[model samples]
Structure formats: C-alpha cells, structure tokens
Target: MSRLPAVFATGLILALAGGAAAVQRLPATPEPARLTGWPQPAEMPGFGDDGTLGPAEISDLTEYVLALAGAQRDEAAVIRAVPLYQTHCAACHGLGGEGAEILGTPDLTRRQFRVVTGPADIRLQIWHGDDGRGPMREAQRRSGRPHG
Candidate 1:
C-alpha cells in the first residue's frame, strides 16, 4: 500500500474529530421571546377604528374583507358581505378589490399598503377613508356610510 492513502486517511480523521469537538463546544441557542400583544400600530391614535359594527360583526366582516383581499377564508362571511362590498367598496376598490390607481385607491388584495397593516388598519380605513380627512370623508358621509 502507498503511504499516500495512510496520510489522507489520517488527515480526514483529524478533520472529522476537530469538527466534532468544535460542535460540542458551541453554545446552545436560546429560544426567542414570545410576543404578548398586537403590534403597537394597531393601538395608535386614529388607527384602531373598529367602526360601527359590533364585535361579532367586526370579526365576521374582517374575515370576509381579508378573504376578499386573498389573505383569509370564510366563505359564509364572504357571501354575507358581498352585497355590502358591492354597494360600498366596489365603486372605487373594484369588484375584486383590486383598487383604482387613478382614483388613488390602494389595492386591498395586498396584505399591507401605506397605513393599512392588517384588519384593524382596514377597519380604520373603512370607517375613516384613506387619510381620515377631505373628499373621501365627504363621499362616505354623503353615501350614508359610517365616517368616523
């Protein structure tokens, strides 16, 4: 047998032993801290508007809205809210909630856009329109939709 084989085998054994020892000496990673509450933005002023809907209604409608946005699923809720969306949202938001860029409406299908972060932010937008001020507010008020 050539001495080359023996040298290669010794080097491989030493490398394996060194790697194992290094791994054994490594510190254990600690578990990440658990979060206790909703994100701070949801609780900020002028952002957490739950609107005129009752808690149950809000929850159900939120499920429906998120579903329309392609973020969630609740067939019953979607069915129930279809007419409401058609009446109130489809005008500017588009029938599929794709939004109208020329009209400055943000696409609802996306999970986040501008001030809208989640359901709470969506609720605020639904209640207050885009900026909680100006023409959209007047339009919502004139249309008899909740504008707070």
Candidate 2:
C-alpha cells in the first residue's frame, strides 16, 4: 500500500479519537430525558362529541386555549371559550354565551356588565346563578342541586 500522507493519518486518528470520546459521553439511559415538560401538543388526545379531553384532546385544548389568552381577536378568551360555552354553559347562556334577553341573561356588553376581575368572580357567575336572563337560577331551582 502507498504510504499514507501524514496529514491524512493524523486526521484519521483524531476522528477515531473524537468518536470514541463521544461514545463514552453518551448516556446509556440518555440522561433520563429530563422530562422538560408536558408532551408535544400535537400528541394531545382528540376531543370527543361530549367535548371532553382525551389524552390527546386534553393536551391539545390546553395548548390552544392557553395560546389564545395572548392572541388578538374580538375576544380570544371568548373564541377559546367556545368549548366551555358549548359544554357547561350553552343550556342556559345561549349557544355563544351571549346573554338571553328573554330569560334576562346579562348582556355581555362590557358597558352592560359591571367591572369584574379575578377568575373566582367569573367562576362564581358560572357556578352560581347569573339570572340576568339565563336559566342558571331556574336550573338551580329545578335541579335543587348545587348551582354547579
């Protein structure tokens, strides 16, 4: 065989040495993956007809809704809220969660509603009865269960 060039021999040795070092540095368990956080959103479970989260849907909706809070829309919260409105709310609040005038639902016009802040306050409206026009009060009356 022809004598190898000194530069080529040196490079080959260095490459082999670097590769060996890399193999040693690599972890057998891959550092246990560190579990940076929740799995990728694309891996989320699909939302069922009832609008409940599956392993996939839970991951997806969480990502979507959280993303909306920072987005620009007529009301990103309202848009992201479609699922919630369709679920716990549509029966009394109307399809869009727009207050019902006939039932005395509180018109969501910011001008109409009083200054409000905090999630519990909003949750209270959802939990208690916003009988401004919605059937929340009636549901409470008929069900005789907690206002949910």
Candidate 3:
C-alpha cells in the first residue's frame, strides 16, 4: 500500500511491457529496400564501385587531373574550386584544410599527408575514402561530379 512500492511495481511492469513490445516489433531478418531512383553502380573514372584502383590507373588519372588543373591555373580556377571545396570538403577538412582532429581528418595544408603524397594521392583519397576512416563515397555518388 506504500507509495514507494506502488511506484516501483509500476516501473517494473512498464519495463517488462516495453521489453515485450520491443521483442514483438523486431524482425527475424532485416531486408533493406532498394533505392530505385539512385544511380546504378558504375565504374567511376579512377575507381570502381567496390573502391578498387590499380596503381597505374590511379597514376594516369592523377596526371590527367593535375594537367587539367595546371592548365586552368588562374584566379578563376581558384575562385571556382573554393565554393566546391567548401561544399564538399570543409565539413571534415576545415575552412583552410586545417582538418578536424576529432574526426581523424588530415590537415590538407600540411607538406606531408597521412595517406596522400601529391595531387594524385589526394584525388585517390577523395574518390575512395580510407576504409577504416569516414566515407565520401555517399557524397560523391550523390553529387554526380566526375572524380579524378
């Protein structure tokens, strides 16, 4: 009859009821729905859907992209890249490529990188995110931008 015992009993009953409801709601096996509207998996410029890229392929692609970048080396190119970088890279890389230490994002402005050594390396990293690290694959897939 005490208020304390009554409250305790009510809590125990609610917890057991909630547990039963949770168990009932759980599926025996999860089957995720396919997103028909999304792009069908296709081989990207420098990589594949499975995120594989040979050294030769990566080198060729890197050279091509760097050449293009070099050709467009001007104020206009920098201006264009700024917005794209902000939209895609800023969340993890920071406004000035300083990187988010908490997220394990490397400082882009540094002379040496944890995973990348040059322009080609940067492209590879951007295209195929480090397996143990975070992902840009979803961003790349959604953006539909051609990757180097």
Candidate 4:
C-alpha cells in the first residue's frame, strides 16, 4: 500500500472538517449595523434628477452615434473620432489598427472585418464588445465609454 493515498485521504478529511467547523462557527442571524452619519443619496450634477436618460433621449443619442459612425470620413467627425479612438481603443487595437496578438486584439485596418458588416454593426460591437474573444467587452463596460 502507498502512503500517498492515505496522505491524500487525510488531507481531504481535514479540509472537509475545517470547512464544516468554520460553517458551524458562523452566526445564524447576522445583526444589521445601526445607520450612522453616512451621507444620504443625493441627485448628482449633470445626470438630471434620476441619473438616467429617457427612452426618447436614448433613441436620439443612438441615432446620432450611428450617424457619426456612418460619417467617419467627414473631416470634423474624423478629427473627433481620431482622439476618441486613440484614448479608448489604441491601447489594445494599436494606434493604427495593427492589433496586439499577445493581447488577442484583432487588426482593424483590414478591408474585410471578421465581425463588423456595416456602421450599425461597428456601433453594436463598440457598445457591447466581443464575447468570443478576450476582455474587450468588460474593458469597455468598466471604462464607461458613452456608447450613445
């Protein structure tokens, strides 16, 4: 007989016993702390009273974003987009869309895109991020880059 099996069994038993003991030590009813001098929730500046955009406002903003995507070649839009892209996307996608293979970022300069079909598709991807790939979606979400 090997000592390895006995050692493994003993370790597992000890781990289970430890977990059970810890669980048993937990309080059945947790006490809620009395509210002290914490600041009450207040309306934030620049967010209206509710901190949200209405449906119509959201729709209009989405339409405006779509228009901007469609007008990427327009001089003013290009100027605005260039800085935005550099700030938000260049870290992963590269400054010139060359992509970073080590980070699994895809090249964007290619004529044929694997994911995007049109301006709307690009906008959706920008807003939602890629699910099949890395943390692009989560990164966009954390950055809170205004999609609309």
Per-residue lDDT of candidate 1, residues 1-148 (tens digit):
6899999999999999999999998779956544344222121122114444444444555676699667657788778777767765677668887876655565767643564445665554555444434223434356554433
**Candidate 3 residue pairs that clash:** none
Model 3: lowest-lDDT 10 consecutive positions: 41-50
Best by TM-score: 1
**lDDT at position 128, candidate 4:** 48
Q: List TM-score per model, in order.
A: 0.47, 0.30, 0.40, 0.41
Ranking by lDDT: 1, 3, 4, 2
For every candidate structure, what is the RMSD over all alpha carbons to the true structure, in angstroms?
Answer: 14.3, 18.4, 13.6, 16.4
Residues 21-51 of candidate 2 have per-residue lDDT tens digits of 9999987876444324533211111133223
| Candidates 3 and 4 compared by lDDT, better number | 3
Clashes of each: 0, 10, 0, 0
lDDT of 4 by residue, 1-148 (tens): 7799999999999999999999999899977653344333211122112334433333333343343434344355555456555655666667776665555555666522344545544544555445564223433456554543
RMSD of 2: 18.4
Residue-level lDDT for 125 in candidate 4? 50
Q: Which 10 consecutive residues of model 2 have the lowest summed lDDT?
A: 40-49
Q: Give residue 106's lDDT in candidate 1 (0 to 100).
A: 57
Rank ordering of all candidates by TM-score, starting from the highest: 1, 4, 3, 2
lDDT of 4: 0.50
Task: Give Cα distance to truth, residue 85, candidate 1, Å.
Answer: 0.2
